[model samples]
Target: MEGEEGTQNAHLILARKLFLLTHPDVQDIEKVRLREEVFDAVKSDDMAPLYETLAADKIIEMDQSILDSMRAKIGDEIRKLDEKIADAEENLGESEVREAHLAKSLFYIRIGDKDKALEQLKVTESKTVAVGQKMDLVFYTLQIGFFYMDFDLISKSIDKAKNLFEEGGDWERKNRLKVYEGLYCMSTRNFDKAASLFLDSISTFTTYDLFPYDTFVFYTVLTSIISLDRVSLKQKVVDAPEILTVIGKIPCLSEFLNSLYDCQYKSFFSAFAGLTEQIKFDRYLHPHFRYYMREVRTVVYSQFLESYKSVTIDAMAKAFGVTIEFIDLELSRFISAGKLHCKIDKVAGVLETNRPDAKNALYQSTIKQGDFLLNRIQKLSRVIDL
Candidate 1:
């Protein structure tokens, strides 16, 4: 019992020790060796001997004063990891160094220390240079943009990641970037824009059949729809199997559709009206979903709008393969944005066009843009280098 107790005390002592010092040489390589030494000693039952060599009877009975000193030392060691690019650069050889920097950077960010967190990220990027890991660099850069909510920088990073993804970027990372873009729009209360981005993301994977049954894509779609058209999303629940897959992963989301999408339909019709109004009032359209509307309008025309004549909240949701609540949230956003000029008649469970003129303009613009893109694609295809 005495030997076990002694070993346990030695383990604690070593665990609490500040093995990494902030000094240039010490931080660069000495600290790395010291950390390994401490880890190995404790695991191999060799720490007790080291404890005796460092200070006789120190582990057996440490007083308050000793404990206080240990706390201060530990605090000081941690400080070396805080916002220090030099320390990060020096510790490049260690695998755990970046993680340590991440923890320290998060601590600074949580406390509203923006500059400090950025400084740490710069250090992290520099260290990854010699390591030749572009993915780590991209992750750190993207992380900085995310925490700072810097969309311009985030977009730039996405552009850089396009090539990287071809080389080695995983699907999860690529999808995560889309989710981040969706989140950025959502933060601005541009629910239509957010929903469009989310839908485009879903279409990218789904159309290609690249990543079927991807829960993140499903969840993001559900989340974006909930933000813009919860009613339609609730209705879609009955039709789309993907919704069920997501609910299986996140059971709590099922609560959003409790009333069979009562809230979603009302919100959806209202948003649908808002969307048309927005097209006229707010000329800046949602970049992602703009194509979808154009495609549907070009393919169906007045007949397509006619198809939606009996489009109850549930029926519209079924057409889209999303939740009724998600549809409602989206429709609500369109109504708010003045993009969809449809009003919900709760008494009859139907949608009425709010402004026929705005709808005509929306239809015209979408058709023009689609034609423009198609022409651009064709012209590019005819390129012959002679």
Candidate 2:
């Protein structure tokens, strides 16, 4: 990631390393691999201060001599960067000064120095004249925000980027920001908004620093499935060329998307089973794994049950490729939890759906709104009388 393309995913690597270091489920052998990776990253980036802190925390046990050597190398690099900045300020144009400051900011980012990276990014932003370069600095700040999972910084940067866009911004950066914001929404569990943003950027995705295109498609399809209705799902996701290309590359996602749409309940259930493991391991999705599972099942069950008012429990069980008793228990739990608008007739081995009628729902909503308007009018009348 430190290649000529200049896309530094150092924070993502660091996050993975930290996750592995502290994860209870990470095997000891994996920890060994992480230690090797940690030192390798530190050496390549010359993260002397970071290395010292990790060593002090007993996360690593590198020798003092290695630390001292790294400190010397890092100090030398900082001096050279400072010299470049000074030279740019003394003799060069604004663009050159911006480049120099950006270099320092990127250096701090590469070395996992969060605070310094942000400070230097602001300095770079100050020197940046155009809206595009200023937005680029925001993107860097956003990278650090993601690296640390700092929601406040992320939210403020998103707002600032939006305001900048209002003044002026490029389409490519605007699209990239959508992906960034979508990822933030995913991390925050705002799946509906994330779904919208991901789908919007599906055709224009180029934010490789945040994640690969395939992973982006994966997020797009997953969020789209849960948030979209059948018509919108078919239009935006099931038929979208961008998603169709990579959806098959991700395990079970293709089946997960198609089977539900095609009313292949058994296949949908099978694909969901496989997807559970993938979601459970994903750092972004892990916390919401069980919740997602329940929601997915609820969606699938509602879809199947919506076809008929009453159906035999045995038939429903067969449709889902599960035992009758299992289907009975699932239906009972979902029914009691109000996730499913259905009831079970245990004696008759039947399941009946009782979804609300749309017209009746609209009528009730209208009545509620009328009451609210009447209340407001009465209050206005009382004020006029006073």
Candidate 3:
């Protein structure tokens, strides 16, 4: 009888502890009074401990009506308790206990523990054989590929995701699967493959069947593909002005493209810096690149002769609006093309200019005459059919 009474006292103490978590600690008496009202419900036997815990969480605090509605359900209270347990685990160190189990490897990723995340995903993949969870399993599989930067695994994961989607899986899951495929191709340095995937993903996301939530992912993936260096992939970087004109069609991607332009400007300035001693005009520009190099050349030459007398990469990036690395890429290209001539003098620091007229004069003479003839022919063609 004495033991039973002790157990009952312990239960009452546990109930009181749970109730205290919901009581607001603010100095405002009215706020405190309002919290007490909720706390009283928590202490009552009418609701379970899960209800009391949910009441303490910020998700519910933002909207009490959700909690009130959820409280009416029986087993859902257990689900709510599970959610609180998940939230509590988030506050622990990067190595979470729950992350090492089941179909929830994403929790480990959220904390940046990629190794542990992969381990959890492998475990989940082994245990789940059900058809309905294939998409979920595929999602975690792609996450594993990204976390470890495993290009081969990324390629295989795309195939797995496609198979899952084709099997009549969830619409939302399929949309995400398409995105993962495109991202995987990009990660593997398969830019051409990724470009097609991104375009297809965009089409799928725009279709009325897809949820609005998927739009952000679609735009981000498209931007990533377009932003890749055309030189790196041996493809032409499309004219920025032309690309910007079409950018508005994707509302989610407009701001991101503006940022890409800012990055391109920074890149152009970096290239200018390396060519200060010898302006190489043709090294980095791809065969199909359409931007006029004359404007960039003019700006760089003026800066080279400016009052600041600081023609270093850092200063050039500031003056021309681009990152230092971008300037470096352009410089290397010019050097390779033999368009820039470099020399050093103490007073001039590093001085650069286009190749001397004597050496390049013959080549320029042919190109200019040929270009002038071609322009005349094109003009005449526009005026007359033949």
Q: Name the top TM-score candidate.
A: 2
- Model 2 per-residue lDDT at 345: 89
lDDT of 1 at 89: 53
Query: Best to worst by lDDT, what's the order?
Result: 2, 1, 3
**Full ranking by TM-score:** 2, 1, 3
Between prediction 1 and prediction 3, the one with superior lDDT is 1
TM-scores of the models, in the given order?
0.39, 0.90, 0.32
User: Model 1: per-residue lDDT, tens digit, 184-213?
Assistant: 565444556666666556534331111123
Per-structure clash totals for the candidates: 53, 0, 12
lDDT agreement with native, every candidate: 0.48, 0.86, 0.46
TM-score of 2: 0.90
Candidate 3: tens digits of C-alpha lDDT, residues 1-386: 00121132222232333334333442355555545555444334223333444445741243465445534553454355457547645765323333334424554443334465567667656655554565665665555555345667777877877775666677656665665665555444444565565555554443222123233343333434334443321232133333444545643344433333343444444443433322112111211123224333433433343333335666555555766676556555655555345322325433344344575888888899999999999999999985
After TM-score superposition, what is the CA distance of residue 199 in candidate 1 from its true location, in Å? Answer: 5.4
Best by lDDT: 2
lDDT value, residue 165 of candidate 3: 61
The candidate, 2 or 3, that scores higher on lDDT is: 2
> Per the 3 Å backbone cut-off, how many clashing residue pairs does candidate 2 have?
0
